[model samples]
Target: MKLLLRLATSLLLWIIMMVILVLIILLPRDMEVKRIGVKDHMSYHFTWSGYKENIQQYLADVKENKTLGTSVAHQPVEWELAHYGKRSIAILVPALIISFLIGILKGVFDYRRNRGLWKVLGEGTTWLGQSIPDFFIIIILELIISLTIHRMFPHLQLYGIEHWYNIFLPILFLSMYPAAVIANYTTQALKEEDDQDYIRTARAKGLPETIILWKHVLRNCWSKILIHFMPIILTLLSSMVIVEYMTLYRGMGTRLMEAIKIKDTIASTDTILPIETPTVIGFSLEFMIILLLAQWVNQVIKHFLIPVRKDEHT
Candidate 1:
């Protein structure tokens, strides 16, 4: 019941947010900014008497199957959004899954054997990962590839994402810092769970360390870790955007970069032209949907975790 309530609350919030986003995007810019070329067709913004009219027109567009309107590039916003969104997900989902697995295991290993060289390495790696900007990490990877791997392979293409595996590098770079955060959070949660009287009793019974760690310690710590899942996913989204833009991965980030580019006729002019309001809004709406999907997935995971927790003793 509580979980359902949380889902309901989140759904309500998402709807409110999307509505506000649409208003902001469709809101009129200064009439002074010159609308040119394909932009002349963007008559919706050039003339807006009131929000009610705009909302009604938007609904009409929906009914007429012109939902996404158009883009500055003179292409359908819906088609472009789907293309880039697909690219973004192709890289993002794999990276996120890899990071989660690596992070959880590393965190467990770090805390369970918290002594000597292994401890120092795990702590240092996580700290450095959080400290370093993802851009530099990608740059360093690029430099290494050019310096060594490309030279060694002679004709092999490592960048520009020609094949599915071409994005392997981007995925690795994207996974790094989010994994570090998860490791740190997991380690802390485990630490707190470790000190509990229940853990102490379990240890007192001469239970195998492996069993105590997995069956007892982790079962309790999971709820704490689950609480951080959304934040970690947010981190992944931000980093993936940066990585995609830098690497020119032809993903949503690249599309976003293109959408935001200033199309001003005079570079010195203070007037800010609308790059593609519909495109921008389309991009934003899709991104919001991704987050909504992530939230739903997290709730589902929690539902599954509940059963696992109950069955732990069995």
Candidate 2:
């Protein structure tokens, strides 16, 4: 009965998320850019047909605007759609998976013993990392690299590393912030779990520290950790915005920023709206899977260490 309820809840969440995704993708992109009435005077906008014609023509020109002097090539509407659809999926899906795995494992290790000092240190480190503005870090790093290269090797082209370094910088920046947060929260959770009576009782039973920490404490805490940390996996999509922009890497973030600043409706919408579909779907599925797996792991651990009737009563 509990398992059935869990499955139903999961289905409901998935349905709600899917509905939101569809609305975002289907909503009128031009609404954000359209001029509304001013305070002094009421203004009438163009008819829907006229607006469509203008926007269509603008989108057409966007593709051919080679002289715009941007780093990225201007893509046609279809190309932009296809490119971003694939890119969002390709980047976010695996990133969420890998980051979650790392976070869960690291969290297990950090929280196993539930040491208070370690928990405080972990939380403090994440808070520090999160407080630093992404752009500030980017600028500082960029200047340091550029200046260091200029002083050491005058012949080096702008920086010491090759162009590939630019690629790695954004990925590293995106990964680091989330990892810090994950480690911090995991540590705190573990520390809290260690204070529980069950953990103390396990130790009292002469269980080895390793088995008590991992087999008992970590297993019980998995559900709480999963619920609390689910959003961490999804946040990478937003983090990429700052990381990619600061590094001047040609990722979706750069393109999206340009689209918004220029008020290019199609470009902006294409980047933000449908592009998120795959990321949403993948993240949703992954989160659900993790929840189930965590719950299953929790149950298995509870079953072996203690009797079912005891667990139920507790």
Q: Can you write out model 1's per-residue Cα lDDT over 206-311, one digit (the tens) per residue?
A: 9988998898788777877776778878898888778887776888877887886765453422343556777887898888988987897788778768677655
Worst 10 residues of 1 by lDDT: 38-47
**Model 2 TM-score?**
0.54
**Which regions of candidate 1 deviate over 4 angstroms?**
31-60, 72-74, 264-272, 299-314
TM-score of each: 0.83, 0.54
Candidate 2 wrongly placed segments (more than 4 Å)? 1-78, 81-121, 147-166, 228-230, 263-314
Cα RMSD, each candidate: 5.2, 9.2
For every model shown, the clashing-pair count is 0, 1
Q: Best TM-score goes to which candidate?
A: 1
Per-residue error for 130 in candidate 2, Å, reads 2.9
Per-residue lDDT of 37-142 in model 2, one digit per residue for the tens? 6323222333567545644554455457732112234334345434544544444555555665666666665554336877555444556766787567768877
